[model samples]
Target: MPDELHRIAAIRDPFEQLRQATARITAAQEEVTELARLRRRVIEGLKDQGLSYADIAQQAGLSRGRIHQIRQQGPRPEGAFFGVGSVTIATPLKREAIRARPVVAVEDVAGAQRLGDLARSLRLEPTFETIPVGGQIDLNRPNLVVICGPRISTAVAETLAQDQRFQFERAEDGPWTLVDRESGQVYRSGQDETAPRNWDVAYLGRLPRPDRNGSVVIFTGIHPQGSLGVVQLLCNNLAEVYSATNGEDFSVLVGTEYDPDSQEPLSVEILTPYHLLGDLS
Candidate 1:
């Protein structure tokens, strides 16, 4: 029995070691809490600067919820505000109209109405044309022409790219940014190099509506190239358009062509009068 006990003594007591490790872990946890407290101050400052939760989380290598929790807490540690993340905001580029001439936009009825509303909203008047072949409108003419189709044909996009009037660059992997001939600024949105599909609303950078003269010209298309969720959220919040409708509109356009034969009736209840008059005034 004594020899057996001596053999067992050779092995260390793992349970005792585990207790020490646990105590060390508790100390480390306390240190982590201290660090988190310190981080809270800097996070509060960032929140005040319009930095989003996701942006802050990415920079901090922590979860957004954790940063939000830190922000929700009132007070922070003394040295917490020292380390901060980058503070850069993406400012959207603006372009001016090239020529004060009649503009043409190719789109469906719903798109037409929305574009019309946008024109009325901006006070910029332009011609809406359906025929693509007529030389009545010069394709090469440097005017504020807002294209509101579901999707622009690849052929047209290629042609537009060849035109020297607009400096076109494939902005990111999807959207093409086009700078108007008159305005050096660039406007960005995704372009579908395929068939025309669903209609959506957008502000053509160049066209300043006459009524809303000198203001941005917003137009609608059957299908627009962008993250639907972002656009839908904007519509829901600003236009008072329901998210479900936006979702339905987006889903119908996904992986298929949108039917232009029928126009969806927009509920007047969804329309929110956004006054850009103050800006123009």
Candidate 2:
């Protein structure tokens, strides 16, 4: 009886082993949660220093919603346990931060005015700048939004010229056509070629900046009306437009149909799904 008891004590119990493993897992999970909290604190610090939420999300490999969630939570209390020990993380001083408000460059006063209204509606507070057609631009700014077609906004034209995914072309007295550079597919506004012009094609894309510090959003069209339509779409259907891009660097073409008499947009339709640019990050 004594020998049997000794053997039972020496044998490993699966249930006991599972209990010990579970305890270790719980400890590891706690540590991970602590680290995540610290990470959110650091993100908030960077945001306070003027880094845009989109830029932070790109750098951290996280979604903008996640970044917003962290910011919305506000600051953590002091003496919070950051790891195994209760360490009160100190907030760092503000660094020299880049301007968070983007610059919205347009070709004409009308386009600039429309863009300004759209920005205000979206709560973007972007600076509006009017540049001459075919003029040279440095594009040194961290963030920019260009409006109008290639004939007017040279920046938008030049950017599209360099991009191999899509091309915008217009012939003498013909409708503007957006060509898929890879697939050779062509898209134009309106169904009938002979029908009175009541629709326009617009291009919207987020591309990597030359400095690689941030991104540039291009909203241009083959015609002036097209540019206005793009802005209207942005202001009216921001969530739907943004959802298509999903906060990534992408290009999309949209067609807007308007009443010829009133010149008011009747409907806006997405011409294509978001086409992602490769590895802009």
Candidate 3:
């Protein structure tokens, strides 16, 4: 901190000094926000371990009142599963049937909006973006969540290809499916059946970003219902899901049995075990 201040002080131009100071403050603001979240989590975690506020305060050199306040404040730590401070949700634009113009699917919009609401509840800012019709997208961004399928987005497909454990592709038999490499089990959406049922399978994972600085959260399925069902799963099992991965880069196939009329998931199940990325063992 002193070194940065000294650097700012050494600046000859006052305007440049002011600009550097401003940039430093902006960077500090993000750090401060993250630190507060960490403080709150630790304070509450101690309480869960049966430590009294006074006990924690004594150990941490803080007052009991401060401990109480910290426990109730700051962003929810579990929200970090989706992102840190802000998350940009990127859905794909599908071409209109007749007009052949790019358009966002209604179900995708609902899923994106619902996820946005979930992000807000976690005290994270949410914004929306759309992958264009040809599937070209820049996957090098911080805190990005993509809700597009591999068939629609080649970029997403390429990202998924980095995972060696499973593959999403169509077999000669017909339907596009998520195939488990080790077990060789094929997971196809029930909607693909001859006697179509009200079920779908979705893929959810935290994939490595192209830049490799961090990762991006991705969820997609054979159909839009798969994505929608996964969103509901997220809304209900966020904490559990976050605990399962701990924000690691991994992938899982989700099976969802939903209502035929409303397309609401009645049951959601994790089909395959989590295939953790960067785990050679």
Candidate 4:
């Protein structure tokens, strides 16, 4: 049986093959980690060169909070995965009240409350802004988060309109829809007059600055329930979401089914992978 034994020995072992594959995966992970480190160092160097946070964020296509985090390199605070520096909640106001005291809609207040709580949990400050439809917006914050939909916040709508990755569509006499610009896939909310109430879709993404510096995180939904779901997802599963993005800028489209009476989400689904694209600069 020596010939048989020799033949068996000549064949490759399955365990060895698995071990080699595992080694390759580990090596690749290490390489990614190293590259991240190098990128952080470059950002730090830029900060040292007297560049403002906005300028650094603009150059690196990163959030101001992310740059600040890299610069500090300190222990991470609990629930701070998004690396946000400040949060802004945009609500609708009358055209004549554009420069006057702003009035906030009930739905907008609910959304703002959820996001404000999330910001406080992450030890970040929150700001509430009232903008009239189609009004001017200040988009120069270093790390900013916007909470509004196309119907209320013209700034958010305009930003999404200019972006080729996604579109927020609200046609008369139909349900609100979120369209994927590249794939032409549509996610709709059950808000039509004829349709029974059902699920809603939300758009969440960290996009690059459009006019000025820093990054913008947009939280918008087809309806109030959808906005609530987006906030819930971020608050409850931020770490998981952050891991999915590998700490990179990403956008997500989510579908959430909620209870008709309670207005609570029954289930939530991440409709797409963390999409990597910046706003049109």
Best by TM-score: 3
Deviating ranges (above 4 Å) for candidate 1? 1-107, 133-137, 146-155, 160-281
Structural similarity to truth (TM-score) of each candidate: 0.23, 0.55, 0.86, 0.62
Write model 3 residue lDDT over 196-227, tens digit each, in one string: 88889889999888777788888997888888
* Predictions in order: lDDT: 0.36, 0.60, 0.85, 0.68
Structure candidate 3, residue pairs in collision: none
Model 3 lowest lDDT segment of ten: 272-281
Native-referenced Cα lDDT, model 3 = 0.85
As for lDDT, the candidate ahead, 2 or 4, is 4
| Angstrom error at residue 124, model 3 | 1.4
Model 2 residue 61 lDDT? Answer: 93
Put down candidate 4 lDDT per residue, 1-281, tens digits, no spaces.
Answer: 56534554455986866676576666565455445545655665576688987898887788989778775663233333434454566655634356655565555577678777877665556788776656566655655667666676556666666556777875565667888877888777866536666688889887665664656677777877787788778778875786576555578898888888878778888987678764355
Q: Among these predicted structures, which one has the highest lDDT?
A: 3
Candidate 1 lDDT over residue span 107-207, tens digit each: 23334445344433322333444424222222333223333321333323333333243345555656544444444555443234354334332321222
Alpha-carbon runs more than 4 Å astray in model 2: 1-111, 170-175, 189-192
Worst 10 residues of 4 by lDDT: 74-83
